[model samples]
Target: MKTSQSYTESGYTHGHSAPVLAAHATRSAATSAGYLLPELEPGMSLLDIGCGPGTVTLDLAERVRPGRVVGVDPSLEALEAARDEASRRGDRTTDFMAADVAELPFADASFDVVHAHQVLQHLQDPVGALRGMARVSASLVAVRDVEYRTMSWYPDIPGLDKWLDTYRAIARANAAEPDAGRHLKSWARAAGLEDLQVTASTWCYTDPESVHWWSGSQAARVSGQTFARQAVEIGRSRADVEEMRRAWLDWGASPDAYFAMVHTELLARVPARR
Candidate 1:
């Protein structure tokens, strides 16, 4: 099958209805992952940066139902989508703000728990963005991201490794972080964030029986298509492009399709006395 035919047209750009992308986005927004938000209290303020579709925003609201939660992003589409979702959930305490993370409009020290997930990897000045989030943040800041370099690869396919490299090269050309886990910590520390800690994890694609495979397939396909597109634009031979695409596709089907990637949880404090 043609790579395009096998992959969704949106290919995880921003708005795609692919099952894989939807699942991954949903997981990022879940409240179960809110452990990093230590500043969250019954009546404390919370902010979600790049709050795509307001998943994390809603999650934050649940933590501080009586308190206020704000979700901010530059994309009106994302803000509207998040609003629509909030409306469906009847989450009145949560509000969506259309703004840039790099330049927030909020007053300094306004929020207790400022949370941003999967947003830093795409930024030009990730450190600057972290500083912006840290500035408006009251006491605590937490950001989560993946390390593409540590992305687990178990298949013994010879060509697959080369394809991975090619795919990564193309991704960087588009001004996106090909590997963001290690960079997340550096950015946080450079932003003058103290008490920084990094927690790493690996989400794998197990055999067909593995419940995560359903979601992993979407990620693999989206990432694979991204590589394929870059390969075409970068003048890689069509055969080489197809080889990489196929490896990624087969990765999803293989019983041993387990990839380990690094993740981080960065924290800092803003003194109330200061």
Candidate 2:
């Protein structure tokens, strides 16, 4: 898919390559879903923005069965893959569409809940997108994003440190925020949302299996993803990028290795329509 000006110029730094999609497919509704809403009514309508691969969208579909659930993204490749996943899972209720968050095609107050995950960090106008989402939600709007600066790994691997530096630089070059998690609430407020609730959460990789998966996926991402190319465009050498990839692999191989990435979650209640 061609990049959209509505999104970051880097346009999904972790492109939907096989390795990246494989990692995303591992996520499920129960495992990484529904932190924004404590409970979902069966009849609640939902719209999931930037719903890559639709894993979490399907989970939300299950939670609100007999209600409409739509997952929207600008990438047709991601929407097609998500449709295939839904078909494989026998999920007929969830729908995938190509839409930009800053200008959703839906009418005002069309959904009971609107959610986006790991999406705002990649957008050049996150607050503007949030305002658009709020316009379509009748009651709730939820968002979660990572603070790349808060990411930590054990044993102080130099390569990993370099990886972080390069990734942050690339994000900045794209005019997007790399540390968006800490600013979610403020963004929501600036979007004119009130009755806000903010919380922080962490995704920790400690077990050998989890660490291996996390580190291996990141290694492939740094070496083979669009992110790698963007890093080069910003004057980082290929050899340096390879070194970061190798460091990720080495960290994955370590028995004592652990990595934790912090995310900030915000759930805002939309004001009732007059």
Candidate 3:
């Protein structure tokens, strides 16, 4: 079951397949940025790390109009998708590049604000990535990540627990923390960031439109996404994965179905130059 690629070192355990990228493309700045949006100002350079599909990155470009904005990720395909999105939006201000979080290619203090959304959870060395971010940020660093263990759904369907357990196992096997929300502050401290401000938020899907969208996305992910393949690699059978997919669909169909996921957000100030 060993593939040539090592998922542990890839940082993104959930490989950027089509379904995953589609899920990411649904995220918008208002929904994903949390507390970071209020901090943006015109004429401030911004960098978004692991900026998948550039949906949020384009929103940021609008916010920091007349300023520099760049989105960076390790996947060239993701970057290409992001570039296409920028083109579709007719946005010429934003730029997308392929770069690693642990070793950003930009010079030190290159940006006024650096942000990452749902990025740290996938990294085996999140603190190392933060250090690199801190190096490039002149004024601030903002991040938000989910605590997957705190995810909850009502009217749970059969095999839902198994699905959660399998996902946790796969993430651990990749040396990534599935529940990264609780560790943002500690990781920030380890990265030597100062003047920290931390907050919590929740993304709740209860309305029919939201629930159906979220559930359908998860169903596809568990059925054919990289995580599903990794689950089999870790000993879960294909039948089990299919059951999980059905469970997601069943949950989506329930009359009283609801889902909520908790996230932690933080804004830390990078120390001024000596």
Give the alpha carbon lDDT tens digit for every residue of 1-274 in model 1.
1222111123223233344234534664443244464556688888888776777678778877788889876666567778888888888768888777767889998888788877776665678878888888877888887766776567676556766576566556545575877887788878877777667655554556542554355345545545456567767776876565566566667766665556665666755645
Global fold similarity of model 3 (TM-score): 0.95
Look at candidate 2 and give me any clashing residue pairs.
none
lDDT of 2 by residue, 1-274 (tens): 2345475223766777778777877876655654764757899999999887888898888888898999998777778889999999999879999988878999999999999888899888888999999999999998888999999999688999999999988877777789999999889989999899888888899998999899889998888858778888889898999899999999999999989989898999999999
lDDT of each: 0.66, 0.86, 0.87
Alpha-carbon shift of residue 252 in model 1 (angstroms): 2.5
Candidate 3 lDDT over 1-274, as tens digits, reads 2231212325466788788889999999999995988898999999999898999999988999999999988888789999999999999879998777877889999999999998888777888889988999999999999998998989966688889898888878777889999999999999998899999999999999988998898898887758777888899998999999999999999879899989999999999988
Top candidate by lDDT:
3
What's model 2's overall lDDT?
0.86
Which has the better lDDT: candidate 1, or candidate 2?
Answer: 2
Candidate 1: stretches off by over 4 Å: 1-21, 28-34, 37-39, 158-163, 207-229, 237-241
